[model samples]
Target chain A: MSEAGVSTLEIRDLRVAVEGKEILSGVDLTVPKGEVHALMGPNGAGKTSLGYAVMGHPKYQVTGGDIIWAGQSVLGKPPEERSRLGLFLSLQYPTAIPGVTTTNFLRAALKGQGKELPAREFLKLIRSEVAALKMDQSFMSRYINDNFSGGEKKRMEIVQMAILKPEMAILDETDSGLDVDALRTVADGVNRVRGDGMGILIITHYQRILDYITPDRVHVMAAGRIIASGGSEVVAQIEESGYDPMLRQAGIEAEAAASAAV
Target chain B: MSELISLRPMTRDDAPLAELPGGDPDFLHKLRTAAAAAYRESPWPSSSRDEDWRRTPQIDKLDPASFAAPGSSATELPEYLARVLEGPLAAIGASHTVVTDQAGNVPTAGGSPRGLAVPLEEGLRQDPERWSALLGTIAHPGLRKFVALNTARLTGGALVRVKRGQTAESPVRLVHGVDQRSAAFPRTAVLVEEGASLTLVEEWVSPEGDDSLLAPVVEVQLERGAHLTHVVHQRCGSRTVVQSTVRVKLARDAHYDLRWALLGGAWQKTYFDVEMLGEGSESRASGLCIGRSQQHFDVQTLQDHIAGGAISDLLYRVAVAERSRSIFAGLIRVEEGAQKTNAYVQNRNLLLSPQAKADSNPTLEILANDVRCTHGSTAGRIDDDQLFYCESRGVNREQARRLVVEGFFADVVDAFPQGAVREAARSWVLEALDELALSGALAAGYGSA
Candidate 1:
């Protein structure tokens, strides 16, 4: 976790869609490595599309524009290729695989990165990570997210991010449905793995998660584009006035600048 | 093919009764002779034509005459076959072991015939009276072609008897080694005396080649208050075609637990029938099948409750990948007046290849309203969200899919006969995954069929 490093993720004029319906239009964003950027927007502002488009999800088609990770473009790669290239996405909704365990999934990810660990050392790491997440040891042996509660799924995503040790992780609404206690615990998990040489882009609809992990930068998206970005003052203004005023001041829906560009 | 072993599609002229070994009473020979004549009477089952076989509708075009059912001399097993047999034994060390390699062949170092375990033929020769009584009423020859064939050309069978008020020191392990390109008809008869208990682990192996055809018929009788746990593990090569039928009769207060681990084969068809004959009887059946490539499996089962106060539960999980396919059809039948009967059946199938296909058909026939019965069947692909969750963690799509598929099967495999059996199952699954990975199937196989 390099707090002050040079690795960067620059998204210039990223346009994305799903089944020919455009979602993200001309979205400009940049998260230099070693920094936490809070991405806040209203319900239908295409906030999730950016996270998925950057992760190279097949469903989130990138109709135009570039996603620069480190120094090269990765717009055409598969999700696995993007993952191996140090990009990660923590889905708000994780799929349940009936019999696959977290331990095996983690091992598979490590192998994908050309890394293998001794069983003893691997167990030791798993034990420590499980404890850090306040999860039972049995959780590692249980099937991945199979019938898991909302909080358990959140903790699972955090544990995976911590273990996979990605350089940049696009957390798509990681705090969506969690209570305050679980939210704090998951926030602490993010903070623990925060400064380990990776850039953090926290996408959310509420300001609660911001209370724990203070963002170095805050970007507001509306209708599909990043209409405003600034320091923590932007978050304070949004909280004080709500997203309506911000969208109104930016004239996001009048001319529909985001859609017209697409 | 030998004259005694390779009698292709039975003609009335084929005289199997005179070829089989043993000096049983004339009635025994008469039964075999009648069975052979019945084999000639029954027509071959066509998947596309027969009502009972219509659900699966998929099978290998195997020639019955080309395969042989040669018997061994009851001596030491060959190294290759022994190597396959020893893995399971070492994993689940046996209290008594028996093999059908040859005459005087001691499958185990010190298996006692006087007590619990004995060779099939020796047990038949030693107590010709009891073995005949049980085999006399097992599978009927005229009911189906495969049954008739197995009855007409039976070889290399075993009998494990747990006497009353006695429990085995360890599981009685039975291992069968079939030669490549030959057909073998094997049978197992398990008789648990009243209040007796035994666990039998029977394994079938054919070395890695498309060189054998295996057809087996098993009969289990659980007397009043008797208990038995039978685990059948079949892991033959994909080249071999295997079809097995198991029939069981549970008496009053008797409990029978049967589990099948169908891990390998090019073509596999299996059937299981359990009849609860008296009150307070119970049975639990479970199985898991993991297949890839061009493998095909046709699985069916029937739970017939003839008396009151009997309970039966069964679940089977199947995973098919590549161009493979699986068909599962199960039924729970509660006879009229058989009230107070509780039963449940479920079949789950997973598809991982675009070309892979699966069909799950679960049915119920309840003539008694006082009975409680339910059946469920589902065929689905790997969850997209789960696959994404895995891939998002830096695992490639292929490995992620494989992990999810293995997880799908672990639910059924992990809970049974926990120690060595579970470990062997996991190891077998990994071996299969390795084969799939090396063939470039992990990435190239998934598609919507």
Candidate 2:
């Protein structure tokens, strides 16, 4: 509603397509600095597509609308440029890069951001962060997510998020494979790194993670459009009754919209 | 041995076959004479006809006679060669170091008991019986045209022998350097006696921009219960052409390990032949080659299991950029009675550019039903998902590609034996990547940042 602020990630009438198939029809959302927003949707609701589009993935083409960050449309910008502009996307399925150590990759990422630190200092930072995540010290020397457990891979993503310390973070399914203990650790890691100046966008389908990371605002999407946005009460509403009640309230056919989203 | 021989330019017609060095023993002269006859009899390999030479073109254009033999071995060491001797090779702390260049065979540093390390001519002169018995046994001139040429023109060669039941604490290095318009032939003979173990590094290098030819041959014989580690490093100038071969034979219970690093030269072809001749013998071979520009690198390997209960494993990797090309061909053969033999060969190639080309062919022949033999070959470009993963972490596309390329070599380089050698190779690989970037090949081939 308000003009996009300098420190906010504003998606206005955003339309995205993948392989000529339109996924996100008209998604509008805004996450200003110092706020945590949760995007809840059923399977194939275009939530992951929105996260990738915001990160400037080459495959997720923007058909219309704009993704304005810092008061500038980030259209046509390459993924690396957007990353350097303080945007982070925690992939749902992070690919393994063999022969690349976690420390070396993280150091390169930091150097790319012009935050190069001395060798000893960088190791110290990595050691402390890895320890904070309750990961083994040997994890720093192992290849990036190579042969890592499911929980370890999820923690590795959070580690990158913490080390890069981006201005805005979009976590896609960070709680999907995590157990109770791992979910708590990951939630604590997020809370620790989510400073006042950093904006957070958590994309999840369930209400369990919401209990750990209470969101300032919650939005629900169906058929590529955000149907509802309000305080945390929206979460309770969805928890009490399934999306059918919400679809009924919104005058949209639940099955048709759900399958179309698929 | 310290007195350098005055180098004289000789064409193919005047190759000194008639006037074999008078001071040499009868066996030495006979070997040379026989090799000379073989050189004249065999013709250069043709890519169209020889399956092993199919990937290598312009074989007829290489005139070994056009380039003069390495000049007076008295020439001062170049800055680069001197730095190498003082750096990684020096850090290896060799038991004996021999530098063969225009300056001749210079014993730069180190020593071994009972004259374990000496010039090839001196070694043959000292114990003609032992030298003659080992020479031509593995890398005989009749094997190939280039081998014959190397044997006929062999100069500035070195011999490293570890006596029986002795274990050398450090390695022996035979470093060879060539000048522009000059050819170098360095022959190395390694003999590890029964119960003895040693490490040998044979290196060939030249200054940048030198259009030269370097043909080297190495023969290794490991006696029963002996162990040996061999490294053949070739980093010649970009304009130089290289043809090299290493032949190794293991006796009963003997072990042989080889690491061949091919990082330079404009056009290069190399061969590795390993024979496990006795029960309980084992051989392992691994190498890496990084090519840029229009350079062509072809490597062939043979693993022959002659005795039952022997094992041989080979792994070779190549990364090519620009219009460069690389080919890896490997074969594993098990004899009829070699029932318990186990052999494996794998070749992996990374194409860093659309124009860059790589070919891998790994074949196996098993005559023994009880033998286990497997071969695999792979050639591919960097995965798009991998690239995107790095890019999303704030690394630019170019840097991301570089990281992926470096990671591609990390496993191979880490497998190098000595710590110094491994570190040196890691730095050189990084340096090669930097050179590729500076030449605009990375930007031109890989997408721009």
Candidate 3:
């Protein structure tokens, strides 16, 4: 890879462990400004762990290696600091805060980043975003993710992404629980916010979401490490032959691999 | 039930019971005389020994005799009290309101139930027999030490009554305030005659920086087919201490809905006794408490199903910060032969600081063979996952904690009437959390826990 620049996030042989068990073992990757990288793997390839580690989740301990963002080390920063530094992580299963309304949560998030909008302006912006996402207006009043459908949750994540306008976002299986229509709407929301040199890493198990938002680079992970890296050919190869051929090529059996780590 | 003889005869040196105002009816005098005897017979509750006072360490230090006698009516309302009246109280549109301060009372005449709803003293003088029979019928002086003291020193309170077959459009407000280094014992009696309905809001407030003791007792009687909505809002100064009890009885097919908000006091111990006396009676009780600074709160509630086919539901929530402590103990008792009874009790506590402590205990005593009863309690800190979720969205830990705390109390407050009452409660919760944040308690939330 080219020399890491100020507008790039470099994972230098990144290693992460959860509950004293290593999940990501010596994985290296880089995504430059304005580029969308697709990180795909089979059922348990530690794809989500990479997103969490990069965002500084307390449970996802960085046992070794370094994560450099914007030409500075972010290993010591808390998750909020990481977010303030223009990083976002779309959780696969968003937590439901029972009584916190969606609009209030978004407003607090904006204020945390020193971008607080006036009440009327904020409501106007949220209304436009909700309309664009084909979401119901009542979503703003409902508790965040409480009793929401799986598709609605995925769309809600995208709505936050659109509002937050982060520099770098890691979408962890955002397309896992969406139908065709919701997937398109979610993909459109992500694409609309993919401006201002915002880099994205979309993690997925299926190639369907990639059909809408093309990836600059596709990387396959196996046994807690990236086994292969290429362009659209990687997506086609995995879609046609599945991950068995790639797992065999990397000299690792598919089922025996201990990648089922959260 | 302990046999403890009085070392001295009842006098002003021991308490203010003997100094009660004269010209009272024989029943009123005899009631106070009997309560004084009971007060002398019982000793102050010991924190270590008394099961009910186990979690309350402040109870052991209480000395009611050290404080001044019960307050006289106030001639002028303080600025703080006036502000409250012009704000939340005025918006409530109470049909009858009587505001009491340390000096005296200022009663406002409303649309209906004019003479029927008056001060407790006036009510007693108007109908001595009726007032005598209703007073202390539910919250008997023998119930506890404080109850006896309250009865002996009872001076000024509101007596709100709705005649049979009448429905009051607005609430009846009994607003009481106390001064620094003083004591207040306000007794309220709310009577809803058969097929009548009424709404009552009792607010007890103390000015900031005051160190006082306020003990209030409330008795509620809902006759058959009657409906009553009762709201008790207690907001005291940070240095004040409080001991309060509310007793409610429901007749056949009667309904009692309650919202009890305890938001202040340096140390507070409160009791709620809801007895479903008649068959087909129903009760819904919701309570919320926000504790900060060095505040201590111990709230106890009982849902008694005395008759068959009654229903009772109770939910209480508490949030504590700084070095505050909150304790909740609730019991649902179903008597034998009260078949087909349904009861539910739940208590949830949220600790916003490592130094903040909360303990919740929910128990059930069902002697009935065919009854459905459930009880559960939970005490916990903010969920790490939830905090992380908010943090990942650029919200700091402190702000995230405020949101979580607000969300924790929303369900209970959301059930309140959607107007001034609910808005006032919501603002108070926000203000309390802001205070906690200012004290740097929110910074110590995720550390070491």
Backbone atom clashes (below 3 Å) for every candidate:
21, 3, 5
Please, what is the TM-score per model?
0.92, 0.93, 0.93
A38-104: candidate 1 lDDT, tens digit per residue: 9998777888778878887667888888998878789878778888888888887776777777788
Candidate achieving higher DockQ, 2 or 3: 3
Best by DockQ: 3
- Compare the candidates by lDDT and give the number of the best one: 3
| DockQ of every predicted complex | 0.65, 0.68, 0.82
Q: How close is candidate 2 to the true structure, as a TM-score?
A: 0.93
| Pairs in steric clash, model 3 | B72-B103, B73-B103, B73-B104, B74-B103, B74-B104
Q: In angstroms, how far off is A238's CA in candidate 1?
A: 2.1
Once superposed on the true structure, which residue ranges of model 1 sit more than 4 Å away at CA?
Answer: A1-6, A254-262, B1-15, B18-20, B55-63, B69-76, B101-112, B445-449
- Taking chain B only, the TM-score of every model is 0.91, 0.92, 0.93
Instruction: Summarize candidate 3's per-residue lDDT along B154-255 as a digit string, tens digits.
Output: 776778788998998877878887778777787888889999998788888888875788888899899999999888888888877889899999999999
Docking class of 2: medium
Off by over 4 Å in 3: A1-4, A195-197, A253-256, B1-22, B78-80, B101-116, B445-449
lDDT of 2 by residue, B327-429 (tens): 8889999988998998999999988888899998899888889988999888888877778888888988778888888898887778777588778778778
Clashing pairs in 2: B73-B102, B73-B103, B73-B104
